[model samples]
Target: SCPLILVLGDQLSHSLSSLRDAPDGAVVALCEVAEEGRYVPHHPQKIALILAAMRHFAGELRAKGWRVHYSALDAPDNVQTLIGEAERLAALYGCDEVRVTRPGEWRLWQAMQERRDAALPWRLVEDDRFYVTPDAFADWARGRSTLRLEGFYREMRRHTGLLMEGDSPLGGRWNFDHDNREPLPEHLEAPEPPCHRRDATTREVLVLVAEHFGDHFGALEGFHWPVTRRQSLVDLRHFIANLLPHFGRYQDAISDDQPFLFHSRLSAALNLGLLAPQEVCAAVEAAYQDGKAPLNAAEGFIRQILGWREYVRGLYWTRMPSYKRANYLDGQRGLPDFYWSGDTELRCLKRAIEMTRDNAYAHHIQRLMVTGNFALLCDVAPAALCDWYLAVYADACEWVELPNTLGMVLHGDGGLMGSKPYCASGKYLDRMSDHCQRCRYDPKRSTEENACPLNSLYWRFIERHADRLADNPRMKPILGNLARMSDARRTALRKRAEAFLATLDTEPAYGQGAHS
Candidate 1:
């Protein structure tokens, strides 16, 4: 009997660790289960991308002479869960053992672990796709007082020897983040992201997603994701050649008009395992060495793949099962309705949400400063906001999405993911984006009717959480500003914030109804 190898949707790489030295006649099982798509009401585009990519990968495996059992979501006999499919396949193949690379999510990993009592023996191997392993990260984090990204990132730089010059960094510094915050210039035209024309497999996936997940958040019409490893590489090359140079300077800038401004739209492919992070980083570094891109651009771009991305994954694995429930501030308001429909008075939020709805993509700054910032200020329940992020983004998997939302965005993990909550006012958004210029609410007004909700909410958040945040060294300056405000002005800001919070009840509960 041939050994049954389970290939998950996310584990699409040809060099996946479990496939290493598989004997001839080994059966690779790939399935699209209803449980995964309906798990959180995933975006139509996100569902389409994963299903299309998985189908394409299955075909690639067959071409390379690997026997595969592929199950479509519409399969009449589909058991609707990964474990059920695994059991059926094991019986059909008459396999005594099942092999799989560890899944990215804890739920799936736990499910597979409990399946040890099933009829077949299970072989779970380490997923070697990432630069750092989970066990290695645990060892590194063993004695640290605070697990910050900078320290972990430096170790990764040394381990990978990427952008490192012997014992020193290539540019004599580990980060160029300060240089990477410039707003986009009015005349600087951003290059378009490379778009792959939809093949038959992608078209089929789109139709299926529309039939099943049409009520889900995002649009399915403009599905242009790279569905195969070959197409992913093409997009990666295009990013390095066309966008890498400007990516550093404008990485944090946001524009309502340009959704893909100098940003690599390769995250979905990278998360889906169509493109390896190491290969993406190496290509950017090569471009820098050849004088095609600058040190800041190359280093900043590399840091995301090698630094932040790896750090978040490690953090997620280390603190899971409890990490998702972390809500240090005890944020309790439901997510605003505008997140789904982009129907709102605030231009920054409306634009960010619209970008996410039109394409399951938003650059990091727009996510952090606009939609994420507002959620933080409004004290939206961390879990509710986290669900929206997970459902909306094409690149969001639990391992990456949970920590970023709960910790980085909401400061729900206290100071674990970041030293401080990413709290900011409308003024910050005004400086970083063009949204404020066209906004109906004035960014400069904090206590008036029709004032930007973020402005008053920012102060209210600081005031409400002052007891917890006052002693935080990084928050001292903002706390001092809160203290210096006149009593009358502070009172008005609180009142304004109260009015804004009152309106939230009038908005539809997240995921319960159509956008108004």
Candidate 2:
């Protein structure tokens, strides 16, 4: 027998480093361990999606004449931990060593490092799936005092030659973010995403996930994530033809009923290895070249994958282990209970959580402006909100989610990931969404009983972090207005925020899910 190759749940791609050049007679271990799912209270659909995709990928490998050692969730000998299962399978196969791709999180990467001196040696290979490798990003950040994304993104565009016209961007500019923030006009609609028919493998995984992880948060009823490479390709095509044309125009728009308006909804597939970022970007650029979509839409969509996604991964790899411990604002409050149950009266939050509960998905704006903004305003602890975001989203891997939650969502990293906190008042919600039309609270009132909680909370956050935010160019005007407010009105807003917060609940239903 040859060496045993350990394939992780998320590393399901055929071209994964551990499997791409396997020698003859090698055994690939695909294990559905319980520890990975239980480490945090992962959403039911997320667990199901991972297990189903793993099974399907194992089948694909077996069909291609590779020997697969699969340990299903209910197998009697299942050891319930990733390393244990892989080692157990290695022993069973009589292999001397195990080869694996370096995992996406700091904990696992550290664990793999510890395994170097084990009885049966383990080898870790670089997962070079993204546009920029970790070493390359570190080189780019060696001398900078601040690691800004715009600078890194520009480098990525030039190095990859994406949308480049002889050292210039195709649209004569770098970003189309300004052109992509219009509110919905109420006449436009989004087409339904491609409904993948659940094959026997997927159905079996769904039943297993429901039985094994039923108590976990989020619904398993509408499980529609792409489980295999073929289905992911189909979804990519559908997004290009149906959704990409209008993606840029309404990328930031929110509607009362539309949960995924003009968004790609492809992050889950992209993160899971069913689709590659390069292919996705190439398709969008071809659409622009063929005149199927505008330059703004093409550049905006490409920037997400080719720019932001890669940038965040680089940040995660370089800044983690200590970066996750960063909480510059020193927020210690617990995450509110409404985050888990979606029982709040704030329509924006309620609706966003409802989407997370029902679909295990929410677009970037909903994540940033709606739920994330509320958590930021409430002064929720970085770990608490970070765990919830990681547990709830299907696309969340620690490398991506940690930076976003700790750095961007809560501003817990002391302006490292973002220049200023993304805190927003209800006026922003009202302008960008139709949620306030039917909402009972008024966005314009800050201290009244029927006022939006975010209005006062926003000001309260401003007051709490004023000393740190005073120097930010983007925050100067907002802080100046705060300075202009009368002491009497500021006190009233503070008291009102305190009163509302007293009635709210922030206890975690689950245990402390550490950022480690």
> Which candidate should be chosen as best, given TM-score against the real structure?
2
lDDT of 2 by residue, 182-276 (tens): 99997878999899999999999999999999999899998899989999998999999999999998999988788888888788888889999
Encode model 1's per-residue lDDT on 1-516: one tens digit a residue.
778899998999999999998988899999899988987888999999999999999999999999999989988988988878877888888887888999988888887887767668677899999998899999999999999999999999998899999989998999999999998888888977777888888888888899999988889877888889999999999999999999899999999799999999989999999999989999999999999999999999999999999999999888987887778988877888778898888898888998899999998888888888888998887778888888899998989988888899999999998899999998999898888889999989998887988999999999999999977999999999989999999999999998988876423334321210
TM-score of each: 0.97, 0.98
lDDT of 2: 0.90
Top candidate on lDDT is: 2
In candidate 2, the residue pairs with backbone N, CA or C atoms under 3 Å apart (3 or more residues apart, or in different chains) clash, namely none
Stretches off by above 4 angstroms in model 1 are 505-516
Clashing pairs in 1: none
